[model samples]
Target: MSHVTSPTGLRYHLTHTPPHLTAHSHATLTLTVHNPTPHSIPLPGLTLALPDTPTGTATPHTPGPLTLQPPQGWTTHADSPTHHTLTPPATRDSQPHELPPAGHLTFTLTNYPTSEPGTSTLHLTETPHPGQKGTDNAEPLPLTLTTWPSGTIVNPPTLNKNRYNNGDTATIEWEYSPADGIDYTLTYYPQPAGSGNEKNTVTYAQIQDHSGTAMSNGLRHAVYNTTVPLTTDPVPFILTATYQNDTRTYTTIASVGEPDAQFGKLQVTGHTTLLSTTPQTLTANGSFTSPTEGFLVCWTAPGTAPNKLTVNTNGESRTLSYSICSGSLTLPLAAQSAVSYTADGVSGDQYSVTWIPLGHAINQ
Candidate 1:
């Protein structure tokens, strides 16, 4: 319900009969105009204004012109799809009609579509008759129109990849066809597998249809990209879509896997130096090594902790058993000795290693 008074001492009351309307449905608005002046006034016309159609691929059905039922002896003059003008008989006695002081008129607007779900301000204005001039008789009254949800989700959530290594990028996509007047919301959550707690949730509101036109094939789509960090367990993801008074949700899983081959390479610099107070000796066990360069390999499986290998040289060949642990081995190099070694007993696909000079630092 809404009320507005014009300068001409006329009060207008607006109301939507049913109050709540659904998208793609019909609605009726009733307007009552009251005259409060002491003298009879000539009736002019009325106008109703609606908001522009939503900007996108799907266009709303255009509404037809407005219809007006004037009081007895009054005739409709100007009529347009959204505007109408009514006037009393031009000459008194010639089917003359006028609103006596304190009189009122009631009219209804029917068959309007509530397809788009949202707030629409209907501007109802009273037009002035010829020779009538004043601030009070010409203001437009604002009435709020609200519509509810009448649509559903057409496309569910989908992920580009189900498996990701630490620091890998992944994309999620979904789509929804909106009701005539409703907007949609999308939310995503990434939680650790088997954990009831949610790590984080991302939300997107008023999501627009990427497809410029209505997707005749199915629901329109939207996409989101994210990076997966290293984790011990698989991550469960959830996507939720909401529109008006309705909500839909979906879920999927992503697993963390071992590092790739590129991540397995040992990172170290050459020309590194080693120092020792006493004659230090380094031994290369089942680990693989290069004579002119230092090398070490370390890696962890999807479910296991990470470990590495280290070798020291006394500038001579020495056999040592390798184990998965963190430690430093120092060895003195013999003059002009070509040191070489190999991992003759080590085996596994989950191992990542790095090799550096006996005294050099290792970068993983």
Candidate 2:
């Protein structure tokens, strides 16, 4: 049930038969528009949207034959199966019928139950006239249509990789249609007791919808070392999907493969002379090693990144460039670990660049 009264004393009320809308059967709804203003106003056209069958098309949501049974002395017409428009009657003098003060009109609308469960709204506008064409009211009234699903098609969430390796990109996909609204959530479970990581569920809210193709914010790809703990073998990934005002929810989980990529040895170059052709000298600071040689990618100073064995400093702020090597390259030496990665791939220039210190970047 929904009703809205305008400041001008115009009121609209609606109620449907069968109590609630269901997919298995047809439904009849009663709609009433009342003019309570002392002065008679021109009759208005009632505009309503009907449900579109899951016809597989975005527009013309429905190929319907919606029926409108107006009360005695009233008339109505449908612009389209899903779009309905009701206008005022013609007076004997050919003048448009004016709704007298306190006068009201009622209508009974019927529609076969739609297999695809979804919501729609109803609204009203001024009836069109010869010189005064119909115009939408400044404020359109809304009446929500609630529905019950009999057999709704649901697509479960799927990840690109059942098992993920360090630096591996993961794509999450599912068939999604708007159900009042859209929602997607991804959660990374805490490490198993001991992995040198804080045991807490990490959640990301930045879900993107690429026509329901890829809906993730760099889950396994972005700085995998950190997003996915290095020590935790096979991280558990859970994704939940739902919609606004929808009671049904869908969720799934899969174990992501462990990460083997860790820093060999970090050699932090405290200083470097790049312009000279004779020979560039670099000064190295002692760095740490994590059990030596276990990695998905080996990065080198090929002028591809600043750390061609180069180090970044807030004090200097040089955008160092480095290169991506097929084999592993140790950090040689390290200071403190602070690293971050972008989702770009090794084939590209963004071959696992580090934003944090060499330590954290290597281990993570």
The prediction achieving the highest lDDT against the true structure is 1
Off by over 4 Å in 1: 37-39, 48-61, 65-67, 77-79, 91-97, 129-139, 151-364
**Alpha-carbon RMSD to native, per candidate:** 17.3, 20.0
Report every candidate's CA lDDT.
Answer: 0.54, 0.49
Residue 151 in model 2: shift from native, Å? 8.2
Q: Write the per-residue lDDT of candidate 2 for residues 65-118, one digit (tens) a residue.
A: 667888676666677666666666657887667778889888887774544445
TM-score per model over all chains: 0.35, 0.36
- Per-residue alpha-carbon lDDT of candidate 1 for residues 1-364, written as tens digits (9 for 90 to 100): 6677766667777776466566677778787888888898655455656544532325554566545556566666544454556555566565334568999887677776665665555676666555565534566667655555554544667778767765565676776664553344443334345655435555454345233245665556677665335353465556665544334556767676755335466567875454322221234333333443333433333333444443333345554434444333333334444444333333344334344444543323
Please estimate how well model 1 matches the true structure, expressed as its whole-model Cα lDDT.
0.54
